[model samples]
Target chain A: AQTVTQSQPEMSVQEAETVTLSCTYDTSENNYYLFWYKQPPSRQMILVIRQEAYKQQNATENRFSVNFQKAAKSFSLKISDSQLGDTAMYFCAFESFGNEKLTFGTGTRLTIIP
Target chain B: EPEVTQTPSHQVTQMGQEVILRCVPISNHLYFYWYRQILGQKVEFLVSFYNNEISEKSEIFDDQFSVERPDGSNFTLKIRSTKLEDSAMYFCASSDFDSGGPYNEQFFGPGTRLTVL
Candidate 1:
Protein backbone atom coordinates (compact mmCIF):
# COMPACT_ATOMS: atom_id res chain seq x y z
CA ALA A 1 0.00 0.00 0.00
CA GLN A 2 1.15 3.55 -0.75
CA THR A 3 0.23 6.77 1.04
CA VAL A 4 0.98 10.48 0.56
CA THR A 5 1.03 13.07 3.32
CA GLN A 6 0.93 16.85 3.16
CA SER A 7 1.86 18.11 6.60
CA GLN A 8 0.91 21.72 6.01
CA PRO A 9 -2.84 22.18 6.10
CA GLU A 10 -2.64 25.81 4.99
CA MET A 11 -0.07 28.33 3.84
CA SER A 12 -0.03 31.95 2.71
CA VAL A 13 2.45 33.98 0.68
CA GLN A 14 2.62 37.61 -0.34
CA GLU A 15 2.35 38.36 -4.00
CA ALA A 16 5.67 38.15 -5.86
CA GLU A 17 7.13 36.11 -3.01
CA THR A 18 7.79 32.38 -2.80
CA VAL A 19 6.11 29.56 -0.90
CA THR A 20 7.00 25.96 -0.28
CA LEU A 21 4.49 23.25 0.50
CA SER A 22 5.72 20.06 2.18
CA CYS A 23 4.78 16.51 1.24
CA THR A 24 5.97 13.02 2.14
CA TYR A 25 5.03 9.55 1.06
CA ASP A 26 5.38 5.90 2.06
CA THR A 27 5.99 3.51 -0.79
CA SER A 28 8.03 0.36 -1.17
CA GLU A 29 8.27 0.68 -4.91
CA ASN A 30 11.65 1.95 -5.98
CA ASN A 31 10.46 3.41 -9.25
CA TYR A 32 7.52 5.78 -9.22
CA TYR A 33 6.31 9.25 -10.17
CA LEU A 34 5.48 12.30 -8.06
CA PHE A 35 3.14 15.08 -9.07
CA TRP A 36 1.73 18.40 -7.90
CA TYR A 37 -1.76 19.44 -8.84
CA LYS A 38 -3.67 22.65 -8.26
CA GLN A 39 -7.41 22.81 -7.71
CA PRO A 40 -9.02 26.22 -7.73
CA PRO A 41 -12.49 27.02 -6.44
CA SER A 42 -13.81 25.97 -9.84
CA ARG A 43 -12.90 22.36 -8.81
CA GLN A 44 -10.66 21.59 -11.78
CA MET A 45 -7.47 19.72 -11.08
CA ILE A 46 -4.61 21.32 -12.99
CA LEU A 47 -1.24 19.67 -13.36
CA VAL A 48 1.56 21.76 -11.95
CA ILE A 49 4.66 19.67 -12.37
CA ARG A 50 5.83 16.05 -12.21
CA GLN A 51 9.03 14.31 -11.18
CA GLU A 52 10.21 10.83 -12.08
CA ALA A 53 11.91 8.89 -9.33
CA TYR A 54 14.54 7.40 -11.59
CA LYS A 55 15.73 10.88 -12.51
CA GLN A 56 17.50 12.86 -9.84
CA GLN A 57 16.80 16.15 -11.56
CA ASN A 58 13.87 18.02 -10.05
CA ALA A 59 11.01 18.96 -12.34
CA THR A 60 10.36 22.60 -13.11
CA GLU A 61 7.41 24.22 -14.85
CA ASN A 62 7.87 27.96 -15.07
CA ARG A 63 7.32 29.19 -11.49
CA PHE A 64 6.52 25.78 -10.07
CA SER A 65 9.35 23.43 -9.13
CA VAL A 66 9.73 20.32 -7.01
CA ASN A 67 12.37 19.04 -4.64
CA PHE A 68 12.18 15.27 -4.83
CA GLN A 69 14.27 13.49 -2.19
CA LYS A 70 13.67 9.88 -3.03
CA ALA A 71 15.70 8.53 -0.11
CA ALA A 72 13.90 10.67 2.43
CA LYS A 73 10.52 9.94 0.85
CA SER A 74 9.98 13.66 0.60
CA PHE A 75 8.67 15.66 -2.35
CA SER A 76 7.88 19.31 -1.82
CA LEU A 77 6.45 21.89 -4.21
CA LYS A 78 7.86 25.39 -4.44
CA ILE A 79 6.02 28.23 -6.09
CA SER A 80 8.18 31.20 -6.95
CA ASP A 81 6.99 34.70 -7.78
CA SER A 82 3.56 33.73 -6.60
CA GLN A 83 0.53 35.57 -7.89
CA LEU A 84 -2.99 35.99 -6.58
CA GLY A 85 -4.16 33.37 -9.04
CA ASP A 86 -2.01 30.82 -7.21
CA THR A 87 -4.53 30.67 -4.41
CA ALA A 88 -5.89 27.17 -4.47
CA MET A 89 -5.70 23.72 -2.93
CA TYR A 90 -2.52 21.95 -3.93
CA PHE A 91 -2.20 18.17 -3.83
CA CYS A 92 0.81 15.89 -3.94
CA ALA A 93 0.31 12.59 -5.66
CA PHE A 94 2.22 9.34 -6.14
CA GLU A 95 1.90 6.69 -8.82
CA SER A 96 4.00 3.61 -9.11
CA PHE A 97 5.78 2.98 -12.39
CA GLY A 98 3.36 1.67 -15.02
CA ASN A 99 0.50 1.67 -12.52
CA GLU A 100 -2.82 3.42 -12.95
CA LYS A 101 -3.73 4.13 -9.34
CA LEU A 102 -2.66 7.54 -7.99
CA THR A 103 -2.41 8.01 -4.22
CA PHE A 104 -2.85 11.64 -3.18
CA GLY A 105 -1.97 13.70 -0.12
CA THR A 106 -4.54 15.47 2.04
CA GLY A 107 -3.76 18.77 0.20
CA THR A 108 -2.44 22.16 1.24
CA ARG A 109 -4.63 25.23 0.96
CA LEU A 110 -2.44 28.01 -0.42
CA THR A 111 -3.46 31.65 -0.50
CA ILE A 112 -1.46 34.23 -2.38
CA ILE A 113 -2.11 37.58 -0.74
CA PRO A 114 -1.77 40.85 -2.60
CA GLU B 1 -6.83 22.25 -26.00
CA PRO B 2 -8.45 18.85 -25.68
CA GLU B 3 -9.58 18.02 -22.15
CA VAL B 4 -11.79 15.53 -20.33
CA THR B 5 -15.39 16.57 -19.79
CA GLN B 6 -18.03 15.23 -17.41
CA THR B 7 -21.77 15.89 -17.51
CA PRO B 8 -24.31 16.55 -14.78
CA SER B 9 -22.17 19.04 -12.91
CA HIS B 10 -24.19 18.40 -9.77
CA GLN B 11 -26.45 15.55 -8.72
CA VAL B 12 -28.58 15.07 -5.62
CA THR B 13 -29.97 11.60 -5.16
CA GLN B 14 -31.75 9.67 -2.45
CA MET B 15 -29.99 6.87 -0.63
CA GLY B 16 -30.45 3.39 -2.14
CA GLN B 17 -31.07 4.90 -5.59
CA GLU B 18 -28.91 4.18 -8.60
CA VAL B 19 -26.69 6.93 -10.00
CA ILE B 20 -24.69 7.01 -13.19
CA LEU B 21 -21.90 9.50 -13.89
CA ARG B 22 -20.88 10.21 -17.47
CA CYS B 23 -17.60 11.30 -18.98
CA VAL B 24 -16.31 12.12 -22.43
CA PRO B 25 -12.59 11.71 -22.52
CA ILE B 26 -10.20 13.34 -24.95
CA SER B 27 -10.66 11.94 -28.44
CA ASN B 28 -7.27 10.29 -28.77
CA HIS B 29 -6.82 9.16 -25.20
CA LEU B 30 -6.69 5.38 -24.82
CA TYR B 31 -6.96 5.17 -21.07
CA PHE B 32 -9.77 6.38 -18.81
CA TYR B 33 -10.08 6.55 -15.03
CA TRP B 34 -12.41 7.53 -12.22
CA TYR B 35 -11.48 9.19 -8.92
CA ARG B 36 -13.39 10.50 -5.95
CA GLN B 37 -12.71 13.10 -3.26
CA ILE B 38 -14.78 13.39 -0.14
CA LEU B 39 -15.15 16.77 1.51
CA GLY B 40 -11.71 18.03 2.58
CA GLN B 41 -10.15 14.59 2.01
CA LYS B 42 -7.52 13.27 -0.33
CA VAL B 43 -8.55 12.17 -3.76
CA GLU B 44 -8.96 8.40 -4.10
CA PHE B 45 -8.64 6.29 -7.21
CA LEU B 46 -11.68 4.27 -8.15
CA VAL B 47 -10.91 2.37 -11.35
CA SER B 48 -9.14 2.41 -14.69
CA PHE B 49 -10.37 1.15 -18.04
CA TYR B 50 -8.71 0.39 -21.35
CA ASN B 51 -9.71 -1.46 -24.50
CA ASN B 52 -13.32 -1.69 -23.31
CA GLU B 53 -12.37 -3.53 -20.12
CA ILE B 54 -11.24 -2.71 -16.64
CA SER B 55 -7.47 -2.74 -16.33
CA GLU B 56 -7.44 -2.17 -12.57
CA LYS B 57 -9.62 -0.99 -9.72
CA SER B 58 -9.24 -0.03 -6.09
CA GLU B 59 -10.97 -1.73 -3.16
CA ILE B 60 -13.43 1.13 -3.08
CA PHE B 61 -14.65 0.05 -6.49
CA ASP B 62 -16.48 -2.95 -5.13
CA ASP B 63 -19.33 -5.04 -6.50
CA GLN B 64 -21.77 -2.21 -6.11
CA PHE B 65 -19.87 -0.11 -8.64
CA SER B 66 -19.30 -0.80 -12.33
CA VAL B 67 -17.85 1.03 -15.35
CA GLU B 68 -18.67 0.91 -19.03
CA ARG B 69 -17.76 2.46 -22.36
CA PRO B 70 -21.00 1.93 -24.20
CA ASP B 71 -20.02 4.17 -27.11
CA GLY B 72 -17.05 5.66 -28.88
CA SER B 73 -17.09 8.86 -26.84
CA ASN B 74 -18.86 8.11 -23.58
CA PHE B 75 -17.69 6.35 -20.42
CA THR B 76 -19.96 5.88 -17.48
CA LEU B 77 -19.81 4.71 -13.86
CA LYS B 78 -22.85 3.18 -12.23
CA ILE B 79 -23.33 3.01 -8.53
CA ARG B 80 -25.94 0.34 -7.74
CA SER B 81 -26.96 1.64 -4.36
CA THR B 82 -25.87 5.01 -3.09
CA LYS B 83 -25.07 5.71 0.55
CA LEU B 84 -24.55 8.94 2.40
CA GLU B 85 -20.86 8.22 2.12
CA ASP B 86 -21.24 8.52 -1.65
CA SER B 87 -21.58 12.26 -1.28
CA ALA B 88 -18.39 13.40 -2.89
CA MET B 89 -16.83 14.92 -5.98
CA TYR B 90 -16.38 12.40 -8.80
CA PHE B 91 -13.61 13.19 -11.26
CA CYS B 92 -12.97 11.74 -14.72
CA ALA B 93 -9.48 11.52 -16.09
CA SER B 94 -7.77 10.31 -19.26
CA SER B 95 -4.26 9.58 -20.44
CA ASP B 96 -2.35 8.32 -23.42
CA PHE B 97 0.16 5.61 -22.68
CA ASP B 98 3.65 7.00 -23.02
CA SER B 99 5.56 3.94 -24.12
CA GLY B 100 8.90 5.71 -24.18
CA GLY B 101 8.43 7.90 -21.13
CA PRO B 102 8.90 7.16 -17.45
CA TYR B 103 5.26 7.85 -16.61
CA ASN B 104 2.06 8.95 -18.22
CA GLU B 105 0.32 12.14 -17.13
CA GLN B 106 -3.37 11.83 -16.40
CA PHE B 107 -5.53 14.86 -17.22
CA PHE B 108 -8.48 15.43 -14.92
CA GLY B 109 -11.90 16.92 -15.58
CA PRO B 110 -13.69 19.68 -13.67
CA GLY B 111 -15.42 17.01 -11.54
CA THR B 112 -19.04 16.26 -10.74
CA ARG B 113 -20.43 16.94 -7.29
CA LEU B 114 -22.61 14.07 -6.11
CA THR B 115 -24.67 14.46 -2.99
CA VAL B 116 -26.60 11.49 -1.66
CA LEU B 117 -29.25 12.42 0.82
Candidate 2:
Protein backbone atom coordinates (compact mmCIF):
# COMPACT_ATOMS: atom_id res chain seq x y z
CA ALA A 1 0.00 0.00 0.00
CA GLN A 2 1.06 3.58 -0.69
CA THR A 3 0.17 6.81 1.04
CA VAL A 4 0.46 10.51 0.18
CA THR A 5 0.65 13.35 2.67
CA GLN A 6 0.17 17.11 2.39
CA SER A 7 1.31 18.69 5.65
CA GLN A 8 -0.15 22.11 4.93
CA PRO A 9 -3.91 22.15 5.22
CA GLU A 10 -4.15 25.59 3.66
CA MET A 11 -1.96 28.32 2.16
CA SER A 12 -2.32 31.88 0.90
CA VAL A 13 -0.50 33.95 -1.64
CA GLN A 14 -0.76 37.33 -3.35
CA GLU A 15 -1.38 37.82 -7.03
CA ALA A 16 1.72 37.73 -9.23
CA GLU A 17 3.66 36.07 -6.42
CA THR A 18 4.72 32.46 -6.26
CA VAL A 19 3.50 29.73 -3.92
CA THR A 20 4.72 26.22 -3.39
CA LEU A 21 2.67 23.31 -2.00
CA SER A 22 4.44 20.47 -0.32
CA CYS A 23 3.78 16.71 -0.53
CA THR A 24 5.47 13.54 0.60
CA TYR A 25 4.81 9.87 -0.07
CA ASP A 26 5.61 6.42 1.27
CA THR A 27 5.92 3.84 -1.45
CA SER A 28 7.91 0.67 -1.94
CA GLU A 29 7.54 0.66 -5.67
CA ASN A 30 10.59 2.05 -7.50
CA ASN A 31 8.69 3.11 -10.60
CA TYR A 32 5.56 5.20 -10.30
CA TYR A 33 3.97 8.52 -11.15
CA LEU A 34 3.14 11.66 -9.18
CA PHE A 35 0.48 14.24 -10.00
CA TRP A 36 -1.05 17.51 -8.91
CA TYR A 37 -4.77 18.17 -9.33
CA LYS A 38 -6.74 21.35 -8.74
CA GLN A 39 -10.39 21.43 -7.74
CA PRO A 40 -12.19 24.71 -8.04
CA PRO A 41 -15.39 25.81 -6.30
CA SER A 42 -17.30 24.07 -9.08
CA ARG A 43 -15.96 20.74 -7.82
CA GLN A 44 -14.32 20.02 -11.13
CA MET A 45 -10.89 18.54 -10.67
CA ILE A 46 -8.38 19.39 -13.37
CA LEU A 47 -4.99 17.93 -13.88
CA VAL A 48 -2.32 20.48 -13.04
CA ILE A 49 0.81 18.48 -13.79
CA ARG A 50 2.47 15.07 -13.53
CA GLN A 51 5.97 13.68 -12.90
CA GLU A 52 7.44 10.33 -13.85
CA ALA A 53 9.58 8.61 -11.30
CA TYR A 54 12.17 7.31 -13.74
CA LYS A 55 12.78 10.74 -15.18
CA GLN A 56 14.96 12.83 -12.92
CA GLN A 57 13.88 16.02 -14.64
CA ASN A 58 10.99 17.69 -12.90
CA ALA A 59 7.75 18.12 -14.82
CA THR A 60 6.61 21.58 -15.84
CA GLU A 61 3.41 22.88 -17.37
CA ASN A 62 3.42 26.55 -18.24
CA ARG A 63 3.22 28.42 -14.90
CA PHE A 64 3.05 25.14 -12.98
CA SER A 65 6.10 23.05 -12.16
CA VAL A 66 7.23 20.39 -9.72
CA ASN A 67 10.34 19.77 -7.68
CA PHE A 68 10.55 16.01 -7.42
CA GLN A 69 13.06 14.49 -5.01
CA LYS A 70 12.80 10.76 -5.50
CA ALA A 71 15.20 9.84 -2.72
CA ALA A 72 13.60 12.18 -0.23
CA LYS A 73 10.07 11.18 -1.33
CA SER A 74 9.10 14.80 -1.88
CA PHE A 75 7.16 16.34 -4.75
CA SER A 76 6.22 19.97 -4.39
CA LEU A 77 4.25 22.08 -6.84
CA LYS A 78 5.38 25.62 -7.68
CA ILE A 79 2.95 28.09 -9.10
CA SER A 80 4.75 31.03 -10.73
CA ASP A 81 2.97 34.29 -11.30
CA SER A 82 -0.03 33.01 -9.45
CA GLN A 83 -3.39 34.41 -10.38
CA LEU A 84 -6.64 34.59 -8.45
CA GLY A 85 -7.96 31.72 -10.50
CA ASP A 86 -5.16 29.58 -9.12
CA THR A 87 -6.88 29.61 -5.75
CA ALA A 88 -8.33 26.18 -5.24
CA MET A 89 -7.93 22.87 -3.42
CA TYR A 90 -4.73 21.22 -4.56
CA PHE A 91 -4.16 17.48 -4.18
CA CYS A 92 -1.10 15.31 -4.49
CA ALA A 93 -1.63 11.87 -6.04
CA PHE A 94 0.43 8.74 -6.52
CA GLU A 95 0.04 5.95 -9.09
CA SER A 96 2.18 2.91 -9.26
CA PHE A 97 3.66 1.60 -12.49
CA GLY A 98 1.10 -0.31 -14.59
CA ASN A 99 -1.62 0.77 -12.17
CA GLU A 100 -4.37 3.18 -13.07
CA LYS A 101 -5.77 3.72 -9.57
CA LEU A 102 -4.64 6.94 -7.90
CA THR A 103 -4.06 7.51 -4.19
CA PHE A 104 -4.59 11.11 -3.09
CA GLY A 105 -3.54 13.23 -0.15
CA THR A 106 -5.88 15.16 2.11
CA GLY A 107 -5.33 18.32 0.02
CA THR A 108 -4.15 21.88 0.53
CA ARG A 109 -6.66 24.66 0.08
CA LEU A 110 -4.82 27.53 -1.58
CA THR A 111 -6.11 31.06 -1.67
CA ILE A 112 -4.70 33.78 -3.89
CA ILE A 113 -5.46 37.08 -2.25
CA PRO A 114 -5.80 39.83 -4.75
CA GLU B 1 -9.41 17.15 -27.12
CA PRO B 2 -11.94 14.51 -26.14
CA GLU B 3 -12.92 14.34 -22.47
CA VAL B 4 -14.83 12.14 -20.05
CA THR B 5 -18.38 13.13 -19.11
CA GLN B 6 -20.77 12.23 -16.30
CA THR B 7 -24.52 12.71 -16.10
CA PRO B 8 -26.69 14.25 -13.38
CA SER B 9 -24.42 16.86 -11.86
CA HIS B 10 -26.15 16.25 -8.56
CA GLN B 11 -28.41 13.59 -7.11
CA VAL B 12 -30.47 13.52 -3.91
CA THR B 13 -31.47 10.08 -2.71
CA GLN B 14 -32.84 8.44 0.39
CA MET B 15 -30.89 6.01 2.50
CA GLY B 16 -31.37 2.31 1.61
CA GLN B 17 -32.47 3.32 -1.89
CA GLU B 18 -30.53 2.43 -5.00
CA VAL B 19 -28.70 4.96 -7.12
CA ILE B 20 -26.87 4.51 -10.38
CA LEU B 21 -24.32 7.03 -11.57
CA ARG B 22 -23.68 7.21 -15.27
CA CYS B 23 -20.48 8.13 -17.09
CA VAL B 24 -19.32 8.27 -20.68
CA PRO B 25 -15.61 7.89 -20.92
CA ILE B 26 -13.46 9.12 -23.80
CA SER B 27 -14.46 7.26 -26.95
CA ASN B 28 -11.10 5.62 -27.55
CA HIS B 29 -10.23 4.99 -23.94
CA LEU B 30 -9.81 1.42 -22.78
CA TYR B 31 -9.65 1.98 -19.04
CA PHE B 32 -12.41 3.52 -16.92
CA TYR B 33 -12.30 4.37 -13.25
CA TRP B 34 -14.45 5.60 -10.38
CA TYR B 35 -13.44 7.70 -7.38
CA ARG B 36 -15.23 9.54 -4.62
CA GLN B 37 -14.53 12.51 -2.37
CA ILE B 38 -16.50 13.34 0.71
CA LEU B 39 -16.81 16.98 1.63
CA GLY B 40 -13.39 18.15 2.81
CA GLN B 41 -11.92 14.64 2.45
CA LYS B 42 -9.33 13.15 0.16
CA VAL B 43 -10.39 11.55 -3.10
CA GLU B 44 -10.62 7.78 -2.69
CA PHE B 45 -10.42 5.22 -5.44
CA LEU B 46 -13.43 2.98 -5.94
CA VAL B 47 -12.89 0.76 -8.93
CA SER B 48 -11.19 0.41 -12.31
CA PHE B 49 -12.70 -1.31 -15.35
CA TYR B 50 -11.18 -2.70 -18.53
CA ASN B 51 -11.98 -5.33 -21.15
CA ASN B 52 -15.56 -5.38 -19.97
CA GLU B 53 -14.48 -6.45 -16.51
CA ILE B 54 -13.19 -4.92 -13.33
CA SER B 55 -9.42 -4.89 -13.20
CA GLU B 56 -9.03 -3.53 -9.73
CA LYS B 57 -11.09 -2.12 -6.90
CA SER B 58 -10.48 -0.59 -3.50
CA GLU B 59 -11.77 -1.84 -0.16
CA ILE B 60 -14.48 0.78 -0.24
CA PHE B 61 -15.91 -0.91 -3.30
CA ASP B 62 -17.91 -3.57 -1.56
CA ASP B 63 -20.62 -5.97 -2.74
CA GLN B 64 -23.21 -3.21 -2.60
CA PHE B 65 -21.25 -1.41 -5.33
CA SER B 66 -21.29 -2.63 -8.90
CA VAL B 67 -20.16 -1.32 -12.30
CA GLU B 68 -21.33 -2.07 -15.82
CA ARG B 69 -20.92 -1.00 -19.42
CA PRO B 70 -24.33 -1.81 -20.75
CA ASP B 71 -23.59 -0.24 -24.11
CA GLY B 72 -20.62 0.86 -26.13
CA SER B 73 -20.66 4.36 -24.70
CA ASN B 74 -22.07 4.47 -21.19
CA PHE B 75 -20.41 3.10 -18.05
CA THR B 76 -22.42 2.99 -14.88
CA LEU B 77 -21.87 2.54 -11.14
CA LYS B 78 -24.76 1.16 -9.12
CA ILE B 79 -25.05 1.23 -5.38
CA ARG B 80 -27.65 -1.25 -4.21
CA SER B 81 -28.30 0.39 -0.88
CA THR B 82 -27.03 3.87 -0.29
CA LYS B 83 -25.70 4.73 3.15
CA LEU B 84 -25.14 8.13 4.66
CA GLU B 85 -21.44 7.66 4.05
CA ASP B 86 -22.21 7.13 0.35
CA SER B 87 -22.94 10.82 0.08
CA ALA B 88 -20.01 12.20 -1.82
CA MET B 89 -18.81 13.61 -5.13
CA TYR B 90 -18.16 10.76 -7.52
CA PHE B 91 -15.70 11.24 -10.35
CA CYS B 92 -15.28 9.27 -13.57
CA ALA B 93 -12.00 9.11 -15.44
CA SER B 94 -10.66 7.36 -18.53
CA SER B 95 -7.33 6.72 -20.20
CA ASP B 96 -5.76 4.68 -22.95
CA PHE B 97 -2.66 2.60 -23.60
CA ASP B 98 -1.70 4.18 -26.90
CA SER B 99 -0.06 7.37 -25.65
CA GLY B 100 3.48 6.01 -25.50
CA GLY B 101 2.13 3.22 -23.26
CA PRO B 102 -0.01 3.26 -20.13
CA TYR B 103 0.06 5.76 -17.25
CA ASN B 104 0.25 8.76 -19.59
CA GLU B 105 -2.80 10.42 -18.08
CA GLN B 106 -6.37 9.96 -17.01
CA PHE B 107 -8.88 12.60 -18.08
CA PHE B 108 -11.50 13.24 -15.39
CA GLY B 109 -15.14 14.18 -15.65
CA PRO B 110 -16.87 17.06 -13.92
CA GLY B 111 -18.11 14.71 -11.16
CA THR B 112 -21.53 13.81 -9.71
CA ARG B 113 -22.49 14.95 -6.24
CA LEU B 114 -24.52 12.26 -4.49
CA THR B 115 -26.44 13.28 -1.42
CA VAL B 116 -27.92 10.46 0.64
CA LEU B 117 -30.42 11.50 3.23
Residue A102, candidate 2: Cα error in Å is: 0.6
DockQ for candidate 2, C-alpha atoms: 0.79
Give, for candidate 1 chain B, the lowest lDDT window spanning 10 residues.
B96-105
lDDT of 2 at A34: 98
Docking quality class, candidate 2: medium
- Candidate 1: list runs displaced more than 4 Å: B98-100
Indicate the residue-level lDDT of A33 in model 1. Answer: 92
Every candidate's TM-score, chain A alone: 0.98, 0.99
lDDT of each: 0.93, 0.94
* lDDT of candidate 1 over A1-114, digit per residue (tens): 999999999999899999999999999999999999999989889889999999999999999999989999999999999999999999999999988878999999999999
Ten contiguous residues with the weakest lDDT in model 2 chain A: A38-47
Please report how far candidate 2 places residue A1 from its true position, in Å. Answer: 0.5
TM-score of 2: 0.96
Q: Which stretches of candidate 2 lie over 4 Å from their true place?
A: B98-102
